[model samples]
Target: MHSTPWSSAHRLDPADQHLRDFLAPRHSPAGDGVELDVDTLLSQKYNGVVELRVQVAAFSFQNSPSSQNAPRLLLDSSTPLNGVLEALSGDATYAGCGRCSAELSTDANGIYSPCYPCLPLTGVRRYYRPGVLTVSGRGYSQLCVLAPPVPLQKILKAPPDKLHRSSAPGSQVKLIQVAAERLHALLSLPKKTFVITIRSHFLCDENSAPLSQDFTLLDLQLPTDCK
Candidate 1:
């Protein structure tokens, strides 16, 4: 006896078990589902709103600044803790490898091993969080999800205090050291395997990106939080 492939999705978000069951056939390549995908909706009306139920696979807090090439800080367990706080405490932008950015760990004789390559991979940036997800019934995976400050704060379960970095880690950092704290909170939350309704948009030239759907999350709830 073998468990079904769709069963995993049901277990991932039991609250959406019915939804998965209803949309499973349409989701699969077999194509029994009369799903209204982004293209269908867009064709019907440009910049159309397509309702979708998706699983939030990863949570990334991006430090996307006005600089077209600002390094994005993908806050995860691997992100250096002290380095995060230090950068938030001072600089508006930090550019350095993880080894140099993190607090030094020295042996009894003051000797320490260096992180080879010394790559500037892990960064502490200032700005947006894309809780990217994949739809349950649908045309693509990894939907480019966006959200307004209020909805984001609710989903991330962040405090409404001035500490929350809804968008930019503004110049107000000198008085409010909230960026690091907020990052800490987001990293601590249950950021995986959830569902939400999304609004679809298109590029100004009158088309949506072919590879990824432009989405604005209407709302989201983590599986654990629902329990």
Candidate 2:
């Protein structure tokens, strides 16, 4: 028989009341929508490789109320990895209160010039102003373990004009449950690359519809020797 995705131990209890409570009412967040396919998401536990795609030019937390720049990057490779690296060589304004740095590596690209160490989760937390992400990383390399269920206050405070009209009524109720369910799914996997997509929006004009933007969860794969 075909083995279950990941493993039986990693399987989520579909009947759990807590899960039911979280998944029962679900709705998409307002922003440049994010799509993830569970089957298409490869886990290194059995596959022995990890691949990721991030929108580099289109991903980053919104900096100003009217700023429309979105930076996103996508990285994918079948090679076993000891670390996750990014080309900080691209054009972008870099600013953060936390300590950060970069390096150059020699590859076919000729010294693959400038690689920026991932920012610390704490810095990311402060930069975002709100929202919590578990911290796991050494120096500049960090792993995003879990993002607790989205809070009700967050949903309510999200620029009202930018929220999905259909989701505004029940966004909080939907997010709390959805966050919990996602937490369960995350806890089930140990050695893997997971992506958490977050969408942020702001009201541009009184009559203008809410504008949503997206930021990707970069490589959350921690340095591991496990299979």
Candidate 2 lDDT, 3-51, residue by residue in tens: 7676445667999898799889664342233343322321111111223
Model number with the top TM-score: 1
Q: What does the lDDT read for residue 185 in candidate 2?
A: 31
TM-score of each: 0.39, 0.18
Question: What is the per-residue lDDT of model 1 for residues 117-196, given as tens digits with 9 covering 90 to 100?
Answer: 56444432222233332333344434556664445556534333333343445554332344454444434434434445
Q: In model 1, where do residues sit more than 4 Å from their true spots? A: 1-47, 75-140, 160-192, 203-213, 224-227
TM-score of candidate 2 against the unseen true structure: 0.18
